[model samples]
Target chain A: MKVYRLRIAVQAISFIILIYGGLFYIDMGNRMPTFSCAYVDDRGGGCFLIGFQHMLSRPFGEFLGDAGIRLLKAMGIFALWSIVLNKAWCGWICPFGFLQDMLSKIRSFFDVDLSRFGWITRTRYKSVKYIFLVLLILIPLGIANSFFGLEKIPRDWSVPFCQICPARVILPVFNGDFSQIHIDFSSNTTMVLTTIVMVLVALFFTTAFVKRRFFCSYCPMLALLSLFDKIGLLSLKKNGQRCTRCGNCSRACPMEIREIEEEKVLTNLVTQDCTLCLRCVEVCPEDKALETRFCGIPIFTASQQGFLKRQGLDEESHTNKNGA
Target chain B: MIKTVISCFMALFCLFPALATAKAAQPATFMWLEPMSWDAIRAQRAKKKAAITKVTGGQQEAPNPAESYSTSQDKGKKRAARGARPRSYYLHSGEFPQPDRQQSGRPARMNGQYNHRAKPKKSQTQAILWVKYPDNRSLSFAPKQRGPVSLFSFPAGDGGWYDLFAYHDQGVNNDSRIHRYSYTHFMSHGDSVDKHETNGIEGPGFFKGQPILEIKRLCADDHECYRTHAGQNLRVQVSFKGEPLANQTLTLITEQGWKQSKRTDDHGKVSFLLIKELFPEKIDRRKSENYLLTTEHVLPATGVLNGQPFHHEHHIATLPLQVFPPKSDWQSKRMAYMVGSGTFLLAGGAIAIRRKRQRKAL
Candidate 1:
């Protein structure tokens, strides 16, 4: 099977095991560990569980204190997961990422071309995820401060990011539940938060259809994972001496990462914005030019033969030559 | 003859004023008797007669049905006297203001002596404050002079419908000097816990009729109310006349768990602070945080609230403390180390990536 096909299979299985596995335990003897993704909870835990849990749990930042230790313990789980899979979690396993890929396939089936951000906006948008990471950390701290009887923050400000996350409103709809879409009129603040959630959910649907992986550019999780990108085992490598300045890698890129085409040297080609989707590697025509590596081992290598086979052109070319 | 006529007219006018004053002094009268068994009422009469004889300088009067039935003993007492004792009732004459009514206007007065604002009734005395388990076992407490005191009788262990008849006639005494104010609250309380649970005790049930006010806690998490942390919003809804009340002030009291006042929005909902830190003095690590949220609507309580002819709506509901595992010292330390080291690694990785690029360029 193709790598993309294999990735879709993995995404489906993980989504089932993580999202719907709880339904199987009805009337069973022993209960299973829910180990629900901390991200599913607004106060952290899903994939990168450390951010809000640390800020919310701490009494004060001090030497050898209880709060300090708890923060460290919370980060350990994410650290372990990050080291093992790195951005492959985004590339091959994330249900949301797979959903975006599926949307792209649907758009292609309708004969619609994907839209790209202009170079000016693309460069600026690359930093958007870092901005989101900062807000993700800061907003929770503000809430922690409010809890400590500090200046009162708006009630809707609680779970500031998740309240507006498209996934919170969109993901449950796949299971035929639209309850998340309604505004919680419990308070003015909740009404405001739910309103924003609805708007973002609408924007997510429209953008994901026209622009591939539009949300990934500013995903806080992606920014968090990028903090370890240099040390991450998975990498995209480039061969500088392969000659032709063909822009195939950049043109084939879904995220429109220009660095793959702009770089003169052959180092750290896996920049922070790369989702490790390996589309660049798949499109690079030169042999031994572009490679996707796992800890320095090339898992996928680009070549003329592989590219032609992927395009379904090799057999057609052979038939044409025989007929002539 | 003219002097005699003037004197007669003045005397008649004075008599007319005297009659009007006497009529104005009479209070609106009503009575509520606890629906006690006949045997319980007879025992109560006997108890009051002994007390009244002591008060009347040992002069005993024949027991009249009105005198015998009017006196009250602790209603919380069971037939065998095994469970919690009933709270005592104090005799007050004027109408008391409802607990939840905002006190910005004229303060609600009970018997003209107590302001429900300055001297709010203790929550320990609000509503049906006790429950009996299916095995007919219950938590026991000594009888007090004030509080919502009730008896819970259970015969079958299958979580059956238990009858709870509660009534209190405040200010009902043989002493004619004080006005008698009385009211009764009734409900049949029991609903099984779930498909699996056989028998258990639950919270107090809702009042059967309107001017019915309910305080329901809408938690932020699906697990439980107390599992939610402080700073997270806990929405409490108040329904009156089967509709969500709009723009009402409710005292978001948790101080008897965490005391902070809040006003309801257009939805008759108020958000309370869910702080995990205990009040400095009340801090006990072993105990979970508990909250008692109460609100009263002071529009003469429905049915008959006489002497205290004005009804004071009092509603108190409790949410078990939403307590999660507290962060320990080691956990905090581990968090600090992870964050510090993670930052270091991130910084170091960026530098390595830069250095590798430089080496390749050279």
Candidate 2:
């Protein structure tokens, strides 16, 4: 079976389980690495970021005792989940990513061409996710403790990222809950955070038409998952000895990661932006040039025959036609 | 003409206090439990500490008024002296004074007073029946007396609603009437247990077949309950011996002394649309105020208790609820929709214009 078809099936099943699983008593726990939003009333699981932010919003002195241990335990669980699937959590499991993929499918059905970021723009935006990850951590800490003689941040800033996350507003709508869409006018901090979410939701809708997986580019989860890239169990390996560098893999990549095609020496092709969607391995025309390995065992390998069959240009059929 | 109207409004405002005072002067016909305010508790603790210090310094301490006041009239006088506030049953989850923090600057004393070794005095007026969650195990105890108020440290085991039933039975009155004052409080600790479990195995019959009359707030579901808000319809049912008592008079009294009375239907349920009684300042928008729902049921059947014959039984059940400020005070859904749609249109328009310009350039 084609990798893209299999990925779609998995994404559909995952989306259903994460979105409507609560109705069937399926609880995947609250520490899921994906964007299974807790704000969704019937969600089977919850994103870990909300709990993480809340745990971090305590005084530094408190962390010296049970608080620090609790933080580590939660982080350990998150790390275990992230390391197992790696960035597959982003491309294959995230409900938000599935929504984007569905929107991209709609865009494709309408024949709307996908846009690409220029080299300079892509390089500049690479740090955006890292900056968001930093702010999500520092803001919660600042809420509980004073920094450099500055007064403590107000409590309204608790769960700072979840307040601005588009999923908090959008996912709840699937369960017929529109309560989160409102702007809280109670305090200035809430007013600003909720307004920012409104704007992001707007961008999330518009950007999907022109670009595939647009929001994935700036997701803080990607920044966090990238830290486990070296130790992840599942990985993409590239053989440098391949004769051809036709750049087909780069063109087929959804995240537009060029490093997969350009790097000849790095056997590990799971770049920071790579979602492990394995589109590159599927499109690679060279035999055994690219492969997806689980614990160093090849699960899927690039082959000329498989590539031609996927492209509907099997050489055996072509030869038979010529002979006829 | 405008000045005359303004003066009329000013005159009415001046008469408001007199009207309130007149209403407060009316004698309370029913007995209800009231939790001591945090300020009152602190003052009582300070007074106790001062008395202990006087004893340690070899000075004679004055006779305590709380200990001396035993009659109902003396209790009324004490309440009037503090302030003419009615005794309304309420469950407070607010912050309590930390004894260690308060006495941190003082020198350490080995006397049992003001120390952890000191035993908590039990209350003679009120007793609490604590019903735990999930398993619904119940334990009855007389709440520890702290000053004029009783305190019970709820052992929040697994963080669900722990129901507390506070009752004081005034034995056979002069008219051979049994007066029972009962109050139910549902206190939640943390977010561990499922709220749906609150409706299971625990309801109006949670008193375990005891012939106790109680008023229970009827919720459509547990998710809609736990805490109530203003503008919400709060339905309460008055039950006696696990059966509904129809036509009972239930009165809802707000913290500001506003009272509304309603009679139960055939189903023994009365619904009250909790109105916003307190228009709090901007900073106090999240503050929740107490509203007491008191129901009185009279049984005509005779009863004998402790060899004393009672012609009838008078049961008064009071349930205090914390009503939050209405959602409309802080949330504007219409404004949110407008802003959200406006942003979507502006973003879509900008993206379309940019695509058109790029196509033209190409």
**What C-alpha lDDT do the candidate models reach, one value each?**
0.52, 0.73
| Candidate 1 chain B: worst-modelled 10 consecutive residues by lDDT | B89-98
Each model's fraction of native contacts: 0.00, 0.59
Model 2's CAPRI class is: acceptable
For candidate 2, please provide the TM-score of chain A on its own: 0.96
- Which parts of model 2 have CA positions greater than 4 angstroms off? A64-69, A317-324, B1-123, B129-142, B151-164, B169-206, B209-214, B218-223, B265-267, B281-284, B300-312
Q: Write the per-residue lDDT of candidate 1 for residues B202-247, one digit (tens) a residue.
A: 3223233322455556655443342444455667777764588777
Candidate whose lDDT is highest: 2
Candidate 1 runs further than 4 Å off? A24-45, A49-64, A146-152, A184-189, A315-324, B1-362
Q: Assess the local accuracy of residue B193 in candidate 2 as a C-alpha lDDT between 0 and 100.
A: 45
Residue lDDT tens for model 1, A76-154: 6566566666777777666677778888889899986567788899886788778867876666666535545777554
- Highest DockQ scorer: 2
Q: How many Å off is the CA of B343 in candidate 1? A: 40
Evaluate model 1 with DockQ and give the value: 0.02
